[model samples]
Target: MADIDFGDAPAWVAVVLAGGAFVISLLARRDSKKSAGAAVEAVTEARRASDAGVRSAVAAEESLALQRQEAAARQATEAEAARPRASLALHWQGGQIFHLVNEGTAPAENLQLLTVSDDAEPLEPFTRLGVGEVAEFLIMTSLASGAPTALEFAWDGQEDPVRLRVPRSG
Candidate 1:
């Protein structure tokens, strides 16, 4: 290369200045690339944290829904267990024939027969009697032989036995 003459400085000074500017530009570009990479990493970390939070919220909502369903099922079971049940009713068939009827929704368990009459023995106990079922008993002594009397019996869900009075036969 040929050296060019400047007004007061040597041509080598201009070459050195150009080299220094090139190096400065290269360093600035490298710093800019580093800054861009750091910004991208920060954005990626923020997005990951947001996604984790959203997943946690969704899981919490699902758990709450399951708990609500369990509570509803429990309430339904309790209501079913508390359904209305009716007591037994006594009906007259004839002079010496009398029958008991269960007029309830649920079955009666452990029925005991108690008779106040002196001539007949107590009837056998029943284990289970379904709804609208009729159980008959034929008393050997006629109803015309004795005055009006009452019979007491106990069953499931009843703490005290109820008295059923026998009417006078015609």
Candidate 2:
């Protein structure tokens, strides 16, 4: 018969280390759930903003002629669809400045500047407005990347976002 023994660390020491690792895993699990919840909220906000955008698009026909009288009627319909429905106008005041007018019957919330290119990039920092309010923002050229683009107003997924312009800087 032959006997063999390996010594240096006790069995109980290894067992305690394993137990500590298990406890840490349980703590981390809770933190992961919190992060997941935040992600879900962000997705919900984006969906709401997207829904408002779709309705706005439908109001403007694919005919692509804003010069027609019908264009005014379509614009009115889109504006009416806004939350608290407000009239909005987007104009380039030059030198990276833009004018946003909210002349509608309803207050617009989370009114942010969004630039649409081959990819989505946020233009000016987010701004909010009430009915009959006008605000000006400096457009960041970061939004002008990729291609000729449309810069518009969005509600940060909270209200209606409007498509306002095709920039001349293309």
Candidate 3:
């Protein structure tokens, strides 16, 4: 057997050291549990904040898409409101005259005129006519002496060729 020597430490000193070490171990275990619980709470809070941010981003994207749709609709309406329309008529008190007029928001383009009478000469074509404009043509034949004559006009709306008819008006 090996001989153990305790020069100055007594038996009571050993007991006191063991008891203090046990108390310190218990306190350290309790503090570790509390720290672990706090860490779990922090993780849960971070998850919640991330979820809220994602929801807010989605809502903002949807709102921007709706605004784009509204702007497109407004542009379409404005385009529809800015198209030209043409009408032709015959007028006379002591002379016969053909009147071509534009009655729309925009100018008429490439306007060609035609009269139903077989003896009338071919009329000239107008390149461009503004809104509320009047183009007058002299008619050699009297419109009041015969059956109603039909007037036809063809023009461009920048999309498709448009045509309109007017009954004889004297």
Best by lDDT: 1
**Decoy 2 TM-score against native:** 0.37
Among these predicted structures, which one has the highest TM-score? 3
Kindly report which residue stretches of model 3 are placed more than 4 angstroms away from their true locations once superposed: 1-21, 72-98, 113-124, 137-152, 158-170
lDDT against the true structure, per candidate, is 0.80, 0.67, 0.66
Candidate 2 scores a C-alpha RMSD against the true structure in Å of 31.1
lDDT of 1 at 21: 92
Q: Estimate TM-scores for all models.
A: 0.45, 0.37, 0.52
Residue 98 miss distance in model 3 (angstroms): 4.6
Error in Å for residue 123 of model 2: 5.7
Alpha-carbon deviation at 140 in model 1, angstroms: 3.2
Model 2 worst lDDT run, 10 consecutive residues:
1-10
Where does candidate 1 clash, by residue pair?
none
How well is each residue in 22-138 modelled by candidate 2, as lDDT tens digits?
A: 998898898889989989998999999999888778666644565575879978888757546656777677777777877777767666666465455666554467877778766
Candidate 1 lDDT (Cα, 0 to 1): 0.80
**Clash count of each predicted structure:** 0, 3, 0
